[model samples]
Target chain A: MDLRAKLALLADAAKYDASCASSGTEKRDSRAGGLGSTEGMGICHAYAPDGRCVSLLKVLLTNSCIFDCAYCINRKSSDVRRARFTVEELVRLTLAFYRRNYIEGLFLSSGIIRSSDYTMEQLIRVARTLREEHGFLGYIHLKTIPDAAPELLAEAGRWADRLSINIELPQVRSLKELAPEKDLAGIHGAMGNLSGHIAEAKEARRTPTRAAPPRFAPAGQSTQMIVGADDSDDRHILGTSDALYKKFGLKRVYYSGFSPIPDASAKLPPAPPPLLREHRLYQADWLLRFYGFETQEILAGGEGGMLDLELDPKLAWALKHRALFPLDLNRASREALLRIPGLGARNVDRILAARRYSSVRLADLARLRVPLKKVSPFILAPDHRPARGQLDSAGLRRQLLAPSAFAQAAKPRQLALDV
Target chain B: MYSVTLESPADFAGWREAARGLLGAGIPPEAVSWHSPAEPAGLFAGPPPPDVPAQSAIPPVPRDFLEMAERAARHSDPERFALLYGLLWDARRAPGLLRTPTEPRMARLEAMARAVKRDAHKMHAFLRFREIDTPEGPRSVAWFEPEHHIVEAEAGFFQRRFAALRWSILTPRRCAHWDGAEIRFAEGARRADAPADDAAEDLWRTYFASIFNPARLKPDAMRAEMPKKYWKNLPEARIIPALMQGASGRVRAMLGQEPASQPQPPGPRRRRKD
Candidate 1:
């Protein structure tokens, strides 16, 4: 097939894996030789119709697979048109796109073609050519084949900024029933090996006895778990994520809501999960990572095991535990203030600083552009008293759930939120 | 009031020197009027303010304040200089003033710095380079219109990132060029100077259209991140409207289409048997 035809097929095949992050890699630039730079913040050059950031040239090497994972779009059994890009073609595409500032770099994944090691070797070769041949100093993310040889996995790490292995299903039973070819233990084993190497490389870089530290996936490893694909609820999915994070020291755990594909298998769900569920999961994930919320705390914010679709997880937690509301803004600690509905981490820091000089008032939060209505009932400022026990009202959740307020709050940075 | 003229729009060094002179001279922020060379001089414009030496005895501001002032200098706000200097002047009197977000002058200065930083970030994100074949070799060129006086301040980012390739980024206010080794600045150039498109754009547009999941179309979300203002220069943006128009139909077709025949069990060579 022609290059355009191949790209269309491959990108379509790869779209289901929603891991487009190109950040947290070691900062490198082309000043010395190559053709890119990554300084901390990953830039989203474009946004796709799905509200996903087009940061990297997220595509697969080929849509041909040996394994028949039922939920995957590129399963070998599926009759969708398949295409593969030669290594040279892949390299050229990356450079061409990089030259045009269309992407951060290449995010190359391939369905298991030939064998696991062989597919991994091909993925590594693309990265090697970019870094070694062309001296390209851009961000690269490689989806690792779990069963690939350890030496090949190590080599893959040397050339790429981040490496990932998909734990496709949350439950072992689901994996066995739907994707029999996948091994949960094998995936975990690879993740364990990667975590060790990543930690060692970081240590080497820190206490360098030699010229420079040997790089091994400097951005670390991440994994994706498909939501709404099986019988897994939010509790089970988050539990899996929490375990992976603790055990493997992962950089991120992406939650991709199962969307309908053109040639989906009979085994998959009839409809995708509500997109808001995916959004809520991301919010919960943030709370877990940044806001110091435990897994239990976040799960408590949800009903049974599912997150509340209407309210944000943080707000849900605050509403459920109304005793925590009306925390004195001036007297509250950073941790206490962080639990406030409208307060983001940035605003909390600002409040801490602003309060050091004088007592923080409602107008002060307004200047920081805090969502006043969402926060007003939960915080007690010098001039604001939450309408004298507003938190005690039974209709408080409904009052805060006003559609106009939610719309205004959600509109500003909804597109920028990434999983 | 003293009329101080800065060397350039994003001239943090010049602003720092002038601010030091004013501060050392005990001149209040209200007593000074700041202007860059880009601004038209009034008929009654006074002579440029006297410069202060580096060793001038101004009260020491916190390191964070100095850094924030540096960023705020790149803001397009005409009052940016005054705002920063006013904050600096306030910092000397009020202990822990820089930490106070509620302080009016400090908050405004922080806001200005944040805006300038955000503008620089957007420039980093949105600048789309088109390949142009020069006599020497292939050179990548991009045309960007930034919302702030950030072209010079943000040039180092491009220089560091695209140092290997020969590239030029032309903006309305100024232009930056990198030729593998050294980065040079020149006067602003017209948009016509940069190439409009590259050969790979068609393939890129193809990838963009295919990767977009029609089942989860959120044009509002897409527009929020890749704002409409940037759509003109983006190669893939031309297809967005058509894609949006065709999304519902495409999704309906997918939902309506019969499920594909499930693939048979794993092949004989596969490690794990289904």
Candidate 2:
């Protein structure tokens, strides 16, 4: 196929991976002699109609895989159109797109063509060429093959800013049932190996080194799990994510709502994308990372191991634990202040800073643009207090669900909740 | 009241120099009126204040206040300089006024600085560089319209990122040019001066269209980040309407099609060493 057709096919095949991060990499600039630079913040050069950031040129080297995973559109049994780009074609395409400011860098992945080792070598060749031949210093994320040799994995890390190995399913039983080829132990083993190298490199940088610390995926590793594909609850999914964060020191864990695809396998029926569930999962994930919330505490706010569809994870948690209400805004610790609904970390810091000089009040919160209607009942300020029985009223949850225009239009079921 | 006219709309340095003289002269914020070139002088415009030596030492303010004031001064609001000066005056008296983010005056300044920062970030993300052949080799030119006076402030970002190439970013208010070595500021030019399109955009549009999944259409989220104001300049935005219109039908077709039976197992091609 030609370049345009190849890009179209490969990018379409790669769209399900759901990772476009280009941030958190070591800073580099082209002034010293290169073609690009990466500060801390990743810029979304464009947003696709899918509402996803197009930070990097995310495409697979080929869509021809040897394994037949059921949920995947590019399974061996599927009759989808297949295409592959030659190493030169891929390299030239990346440089062209980067020069035009169309993308931050390339995110290269490939299906098992000849073998795991061979596929990895092809990916490495593309990255090595980009770094050595062209001096391209932009962000590069490589999808490392799980079963590839440790030596090959090390080489991949040297040239990449970030590396990833997808743990496609949350539970190993489902992974075995759906994808017979993938092994959970193998995926974790690869992640463990990468984490060790990343940690070692970070430690080396801290101490004085004669030569610059050997670069090995300075941005660290991340992975994706396909939600709604298996019978895994939110508790199970979060438990797996917590383990990955603690054990592997992952930078991110993407939860992609399984969407319908053409030429689908007969084993699993197609369904509409669980967009709201995916959004709630992200909110809960944020609380786990930044808000000092434990997984069990977040899960306790939900029913049947699933997050409430109408309320955000934080509000749900706050509603469930009504005893924690009326926390003093002026004197609450940062950790306690973070648990209050509608108060983001930034605004919490502002409250902490402002309270040091003067007593914080409801008016001050309003001036900071905090949602007073949502936070007032949960917080106690000098000028504001929950009315008698207001916090204990059974209708409080219903009152707090302020159906936004977008939410009302997107979810017709929200109207049914009123009845 | 003393009237002071700044050299330009985004002249933070001039405003600072004048404010320092006024503050050292013990002039309160209400007694002095600030004006930029864009803002016409009122009927009661007074003569420029006379230079006065410091009667007493000007109290020290936090470094954060200076940084915030510098950014807020680039805002298009005519009262930005006066507001910043008022904040500075209050900060000198209260000592900790700048740290109180909830204070109304400090909050307003912070909001203006945040807007300026967002405008600069949008310019960095949305500016599309189109290539044009030059005698030197190839030069990339981009036409962007920023909401604030951030072209000069944000030029270093593009220079550091694209230092190897000769490029020019042209906005309506100001322009920045980088010639592989040094960055130069020039008078702004009309949008027609930049190239209309680049040959590489066809593949880019294709990739943008193909990467989107019809089942997960969320145009509102896309618009929230990439607003409609930027659509006209982006090459791929031309296909957005068509894509959104055709998304439902495409999804219907995918769901309506009968599931394909599993393909017969192929003969083993190669044996694994493990």
Candidate 3:
């Protein structure tokens, strides 16, 4: 097949790699008059599991790798069809697709070949040519080789908007087991280098000087951790993410559940990790990062090593601590409102805003756009009051467990209709 | 990063002159960029503000701000040049120079007004309305919300969408209505008894449930992205309950079904067995 045909095959294949965000990067446009501009937010197209890469031209430098990671489809031992793009050919294709408005920018990843250093250099050259030669300011997220030289990694930061070095697995043992050829020390070194560079650049920008700061990676760096490939549970995964963020100063820690590769190694499992487990990890991760919940606090509630499969992490947390419910909606803090399972951040804002004009009751909540049914039981509102003292601790847990608890306990046949 | 500050001017003659002065004083022009209170409205900006008082009327003086895209070009990065040059530039401001208004200040004034009015704060301050059901009998109600009184802005959006419905949006600020008549604003938040929109609400609930992606539940992430402030006026805000599928077994099962509207959760765990 010609380049287009090869791109169709390879680009589509590459979409399986989630983590296609193009935010946090500077803008770039094609002087060649390519259709879209990256100087704006690069097209942040997410590949939603059933296989669609609709937004970006997510492609690989080459699918040919010299290392064999048991979980990776592109590992040297795998039998998948492979294609490689020359630096020039990749640029031409990017321009062609861009002119047609087919994509926003390039999300380029490659399997290591020739050598880690050689592969890293080739990737750097592609980004440099796109940026300097063409002034192509679209979002360029280059997958920096953790094993690449520090100078090359710094150069990668200069041209690309965001750089990601996949941690691959959570545990050091797993990294040694699944992909022994991959060096954990090398990975840590690259992450440290990026953190230093981004911090230095940002600090320079802060000085009250008229001169611009040296451009490093302005958008910052993030890393990915493959969930479920190892024996680690949700608690373990969340703990891992927290440590990485604290230590490496990452922008994000993407969780890519270990999807079942076509030809698996003897060391690999036959099935994909439970999709819901990955979903739960993301929730737990969010709660830890944004909700002010510590990792151990959330971990304490999970009876199984995993998060609650039926309910959200927050709700499950609430159910465990039923005494905290029946909070006063009229005077609850934003932090307190956030604790309620159904009352998201938005609901809290509405409640606070409306209460300023009127003493909020259950009815007022409905008016302010707060989900009273979800929040009402947990909170005491004016119009529709909660039967706070009536319920025993166990019953309260059941109520926090599900919004339809009373009706469900009263009538189990209504499950389909109730939902 | 001083993000979201609107920049005015595009290296106008005055800006170039300022650059020369700064350069003479040893400051590299590339060290820092300036952003004034310009409207985010692009080259094809919208119609000028119809309201706001005369303070903005004389129209802003025209020379645009200069952009600094490089830092290395400066000697010692910025220190060697800035210490001497920064002082000279600061002292160099012309005391009596009001200068002639070039392009017209109407655009800048309008831009600042719109920024304040449409900003997230205004969204919280404004927005008044009553609930109404849809033709399909779902309870959905809308209110008249504004950055300022743009009858056309609110009316244009509602006429086609809620033409046949009865909804009242009352603002401590301004009022809007579709009393089954021409879309127009009244004086304040309408009476609560303007007739309920039960069907619209039901439809909204269904629409909310239908469109909500189960795989997209990140309370902290969602909260950070769509701050807790603006939920007061939006019908979809109530749907946040429905967004938390894991909290309910039935909802969790529903999410597992991979509703055609969204995708099947493909996180490593959900991949199908061959």
Candidate 4:
């Protein structure tokens, strides 16, 4: 097939692995000698209609696989047209797209072709060529084959800015039922090895040494778990993510709501999960990582194991624990202030700074653009306080709930990441 | 009242020099008026700002205030200069004035600075280059329209990223060019100066169309980040309307079909290296 046709097939095959991050890497520029640059922040060059950031040229090497796993479009049983790109062709396409400012860099993955070791070598060759031959200094994210040789895995890390291996399903039972070829233990073993290398490289850079510390995936590794593909509850999903963060030191755990694909397997659910579920998972993940909330504390805000679709995870948690309301804005500790519904980390810092000069009041909150109607009931300020018994009233949740677009219609709406 | 005319609309250095003279002379902000070249002179324009005595000592402003003022000065707001000077004048009496973000005037200045920063970031993300044959070699060129005076400030980003390629970025207010060795600035040019199309954009559009999942269509989210203002110049944007129009049909096709039975694993799942 021609290059354009191949790109269409490969990109379509790769779209199911929803990760487009290009940030949190060592800073480099082309001023000294190279063709591209990467600041600390990742830039989204475009937004696809799926409401996803097109930060990288995400594509696969080939769509032909030796193994057959359900919930995948490129499984051996599926009759989709197959295609692959030569190493040189893939490298040229990356440079062309990078030069036109269409993408940050290449996010290369592939089906299990020939063998795991052979597949990994092909993926590494593309990255090594970009770094050594072209002097390209942009971001690169490689999908490491979990069963590849340790030597090949180490070589892959030297060239890639980040590495990833998808867990695919949250529960071990679900993984076995849907994708029999994937082993949970094997995936964790590979992640453990990668974590050691990343940590060792980081520690080496910290200490005094003349030679440059051995580079090994400076941006670290992340994983993705497909939601709605199996019968896994939010509690189970979050429990798995918490373990992954603590055990593997993952940078991110992307929750991709299973979407319909052509010729899908009968083992998976017929209908896709609500997009809001995916969005709520992201918010809860943020709270777990940045907002100092335990997984059980967040899960307590909802019935069963699922998050409340009508409200964000943070607001739900606050409504559940009403005894913590009406904290004094002027004298409250930073941790206490962070529990308020409408305050973000940045705004919390701003409030702390502003209060040092004078007492914070209702008018001051308005200048900072804090949602007064939402936060007033939770905070005690000089000029504003919740009415007597207002926080204890049963109708408070009804009053604070905005008209949800997701609740109004079955049609898909925007899934924003903000809390 | 003292009237001060700056060198240009986004001239932070000129504004700083003028403000320092007035501050050292003990002039109040209400008695001084600021003007950029774009604004017409007021009907009873006062004399130039008074000079400061060499012996007068000016209080040291916070480093954050200077950084914020430099960014805020690039905003298109006509009163930005006066607002910045007002805060700088107030800083003398209250050393913590700038730190109090809840203050109204300080909040306004901070909003202006945030707007300029967002504009610069969008410029860095949305600018696209197309290749054209030149007498020297193949050169890449792009056309952009910025909402603020950020072309000069953002030029270094392009120079550092594309240091090896000869490229030119033309905007309505200013243009920047890099020829592998150094960067040069020139006057504004029309859109006609830039190439209208490139051969690679077709492949890019195809990749864009295929990567988007139709079942999760959310045009509002896409428009929020990549707005309608940027659609005209983006090659992939031309196909967005068609993509959105056809999304429901494609989704219906997927949902309407019967689920296929799971495929059995092929012989010997793992193929050892020969």
What DockQ, on C-alphas, does every prediction get? 0.36, 0.35, 0.02, 0.36
Q: How good is the docking of model 4, by CAPRI class?
A: acceptable
Candidate 1: where are CA atoms >4 Å away? A404-419, B50-55, B257-274
Interface RMSD per candidate (angstroms): 11.5, 12.3, 19.0, 11.7
Model 2 docking tier (incorrect/acceptable/medium/high): acceptable
Rank list by lDDT: 4, 2, 1, 3
State each model's TM-score restricted to chain B. 0.89, 0.88, 0.37, 0.88
Please state the Cα-based DockQ of model 2 relative to the true two-chain complex. Answer: 0.35
Off by over 4 Å in 4: A405-419, B40-45, B257-274
| Per-residue accuracy of model 3 over A1-419 as CA lDDT, tens digit each | 46655564456446445565656555433223422344333332222212222244577788899998888868898887888888998887765443322345677888899898999999889988887776565667888898788889889888877788888888889999999899888888889889999999889877867887877877788877887788877766787789888987787777776654455687865455655555566667767766778888787667766777555677678767777877887787888877876665545665565556456666544443444455655777666556656334466555554643211111011101110
Give stretches of model 3 more than 4 Å off.
A27-53, A367-369, A388-419, B1-274
Q: Which of candidates 3 and 4 is the stronger one according to DockQ?
A: 4
lDDT winner, 1 or 4: 4
| Model 2 C-alpha lDDT per residue in residues B142-239, reported as the tens digit of each score | 99999888888999999998999999999898899999879998877899988899999999999999899877777766776688999988898999
DockQ top scorer: 1
The CA lDDT at B104 in model 4 is 94
| Ten residues in sequence with the least summed lDDT for candidate 3 chain B | B66-75
Tens digits of lDDT, candidate 1, A1-419: 98888888888888888888888888887666767898877788888766678888989999999999888878889888888999999899998888777889989999999999999999999999999999898899999999999999999999999999999989999999889999999999999999999999999998959678888999999998888989899999888988998899998888887777767789988877766667677778878877888888988877899887777888889888998779999999999988888798878988887777789999888888787889999988898989866899989888878843242222212224432
Worst 10 residues of 2 chain A by lDDT: A410-419
What are the per-residue Cα lDDT tens digits for candidate 2 across A1-419?
A: 78899999999999998888888889999999988999977878888776677889999999999999999988898898999999999999999989888888999998889899999999999999999999999989999999999999999999999999999989999899889999999999999999999999899888896898888998999999988888899999999999999999998888888878887776674564457777677777888888999999999889989887677789899999999888999989999999998898889999999998999999998888887888889988899899889899999988887643212222111100110
Residue A218 error, candidate 3, Å: 1.9
